[model samples]
Target: MVGSCSVRFPINLEYLHRTHPHVTTYEPEMFPGLHYRMVVPKVTFAIFKSGKVIITGAKNKMDIDNAFNQVYPILKSSIKITEIL
Candidate 1:
């Protein structure tokens, strides 16, 4: 199956910075919150406020799903997965 979804997990800036050191972190005033930019092999992930995570530039769907699952527990019930453009 060609899985398509984006998962958002609630997390604080401190934790994100500590965990994904390889990813770049940016704070834009227009967004009015903190955000993270991560480039992992064949995928790119962007984490934003309200626990909204945007995963793009991926080579395949499985890679996105795996990344989502890996961070699923972090946000617990606050996690949300969207399967659409």
Candidate 2:
């Protein structure tokens, strides 16, 4: 199954890549989003700088939910806070 969602917040892709090099694959020259692999649920996520997430390889909705739940916190922590006046 493939599912997609948006956190509706900007994500710091570079920071996320720097922090989590093991599970993330980022090649800006080739792709815009980061490819993140999860072990337990066995899903892959295409995480974009715009906070858009595409979940792939999930067998069911439960697995998709699980993957989203697991990744939410990490994405929250990686939010790119900006100043706009």
lDDT of 2 by residue, 1-85 (tens): 9999889998888877888999999999999999999998999999998989999999999999999999898889875333221
TM-score of 2: 0.92
lDDT of all predictions, in order shown?
0.51, 0.89
Off by over 4 Å in 1: 1-9, 30-41, 74-85
Best by TM-score: 2
Model 2: CA > 4 A from native: 80-85
Candidate 1 global lDDT? 0.51
TM-scores, all models, native as reference: 0.52, 0.92
lDDT of 2 at 33: 96
lDDT of 1 by residue, 1-85 (tens): 2233334444454455555566646455455334434344355555554556666665677777776676556535332222111
